[model samples]
Target: MRFAAALTAGAALIAAILSPETALAAEAHELPGAAMSLWWVLPFAGLLLCIATGPLLFHHAWEHHYGKIAAFWAALVIGPLAIAFGIPSATQAVLHALLTEYMSFIILLFALFTISGGIFVAGNIHGTPLVNAGLLLGGAVLASVIGTTGASMILIRPLIRANDNRRFNAHVVIFFIFLVSNIGGSLTPLGDPPLFVGFLRGVDFFWTTVHLLPETLFVAGVVLAVFLAIDIILHHREEGAPKIKDPTPDTKVRIRGLANIPLLAGVIAAILISAAWKPGVSFAFQGVSLELQNLVRDAAIMILAFTSLVVSPKEFRGANAFSWGPIAEVAKLFASIFICIVPVVAILRAGLDGALAPLVLLVSSPTGAPDNLAYFWLTGALSSFLDNAPTYLVFFELAGGDPQHLMTELASTLAAISAGAVFMGANTYVGNAPNFMVYAIARHRGIKMPSFFGYMAWSGAVLIPTFLLAGFLFFR
Candidate 1:
């Protein structure tokens, strides 16, 4: 059934690409945001809720039918949109999301996942507090280079293996999500999806690195300290107990799949080339504009992924336990998310005059200026549940869509939004894509992982205070 659905979706995408009806007309009529009501947001909200609860409440059913469930919610929006705004408008909207946003998003994830999956860390070391903290620190730095997904996949197994002899190690994986999967990604656009969306929207590729440095360092430093403290206590707790037999004992560390290292560098260079080399040429399809550089970037990334597959030894992938399942799940779920998000983004773009007027007001000060603090919390809070990429977009527009102005005059506001979206995503397993992947992998490896709510409790105790302090010191 899943394979059939994928084939159907692929066919639909191809048909949409080929149809001349997709060409943009001279006077394109956009769906007026002011005319749409808050009710239009229900489908998007419902889809997210289903994602949050489905695994916990109905694991068997959800595993088998999540794609169908996503489709059902997407239809609720598309069907109503066509009825109210006409089929052409509805088709344009869906095409815009799929072609423009979803394609770039999924391709980047695919490249990162594939290339990182080929690079396996061979051998393991004992998980002392110092060793664990060092691994977390190294992974955090690597996250900005390869991406949170890439860093997590490359280091997670070794970290797990190092601690396999420890009795109390769930906290180790929990902190891994906090640092490596979420906060550490704040430094580069390639590190996290939300920042990449910012990049595609005209923000400079290096803007995040310059603007978010202080916040990233402060938050990452504090979190690493917290992890060290907690890990120390836990390490002491298991001191006297007979250590479990180490499956992969300590050995000199060596890395396999060395060929993929160049491929990974190629991926980064491709992104830089795309950003820097623009010919000012674009192809428009039915209101969706495809730029030449972006097309080149996506093509280059796919080539890199394919190169990794060919050059890297199959045994390396097997050692890394690579499978297509995680990327496939991300592709299916995010396709629907991007589609369902169209109306919600429109409503948000409408601002104070639209149905989401209360949201606009909440993020503004009495002087009518944009509130950096509110932008931080609201963007972070929504990102904790909704996908952070769109959540960042909504607030990015709310603060004014001019990237030049954001980078210069309102740099603090942009930094706050970036920090919130990246940091607070660790609040739950579903907050970020890598968070859930790490959770599933840990559980499969026999860690007694926390339940959804249980994980939130951990974040609430550890992260919320840290964020509050950071907000007070920085965003305020």
Candidate 2:
């Protein structure tokens, strides 16, 4: 894989340097297009090619899971550097800038630490549908207070433990992701980054909550209904599994270490302060300040909040069966995702204005485009594979030109971006960072999880429809 990336880099460098001036000019001035651009399609094509050649290249290792490694190597190593040389200079500039920016790194680190905290806290929970649901409900509210990433990290292990007895508890975690980790956070600027971005764009923080609550409730209601039905079925299935006698009744329920609550509170306070703090606004400096603030807050929370975890007695930690395994898994796998998506994000941003002319022309048309549902679907589809944050930015910037119906267009566009990125993020193992964390944590606790393809089948059967319905309700 490294050799392939080196080859790709060599080819891209040759293309960039040796091409004629006319060719370079053609590359620079090429029509704004989607999918058609080599920048967008080439990497995907290479992924497919890698999948096809996986068997031939790895031979015996092919049977042992080499495909994932090859794909990862291609994406992390070859993907960015190749596109930097192959794509126009503009695309290269954005990718390069994002890589160097410590804000992105800090944001990612915060996510990592948040996962760690969640694993530790949630590990104490035992697998029971009621307990799990309670934990998730608490997580949903906490997510708004501490940030979704933080809540996810702090609660995921507990949620996993709460459902440990039921094999069919995927639905529990699925709904957890849908509600607690994603949609529930819409009400606060501290809740989700997209809303936070909106806050920075002149929208007041409280106003965001006022406007978002209805949508959040609507989504939550539907998800809760689905969860109840699935949990009932799983409960019936659990009756058939072997049951062990309880040796210690309710000993695990004792709240001996209630002191940790204050530490958790400290974490939340730090996050709120960080979110509210600003060095005023500057067109140039706003980006830098926001990014730096996130870093400071992330570090503060990790350093300060962990004191509680450390001071808690061994019994409480043992009851939760807490360990560092799940967070470690999340860190290892997500690095590939964060790095690989850089080029895809750059290409999407570069092309959003030019490609999908039918949609773009309409958005620019006097009648205005019909909310570009096609663009919504396309963005949603790619967002399933790419990090949805950048995907949201791509479409938000794409719809920026519609000044005549700016509010309506921007609202529709934002709705689509938010819905697509958040909802479709459940589509695969790598679809969202936390999805993999949940899966890994579940597996480590002896819960048999579906395979990658198995998970997609489940998602296709269930979540895809929910996503489609969400798109209709929100986008229209």
Clashes of each: 2, 14
> What are the per-residue Cα lDDT tens digits for candidate 1 across 1-476?
99978755754553343222333421245666666766677778888778777878998998889989999888777766654565778888899889878898789778978888888888877899999999999999999987888888788888888898899989999999999999989999989989988997889988999989999999999999999999999898888888778777667889988888898889888987887788999999986789999999999999999999999899988876677876777778878888887877777777877777888898889998879999999899878877788889889988988999999999999999999999999998768888877886787677998877788889999999999999998889
- Model 1 stretches astray by more than 4 angstroms: 1-29, 200-205, 240-242
Whole-model lDDT for model 2 versus the true structure? 0.56
Which predicted model would earn the best lDDT?
Answer: 1
Error of 1 at 18 (Å): 32
How many clashes in candidate 2?
Answer: 14
| Cα lDDT, all candidates | 0.84, 0.56
Range of the 10 consecutive residues with the lowest summed lDDT in candidate 2:
281-290
Q: Clashes in model 1: which pairs?
A: 22-286, 23-286
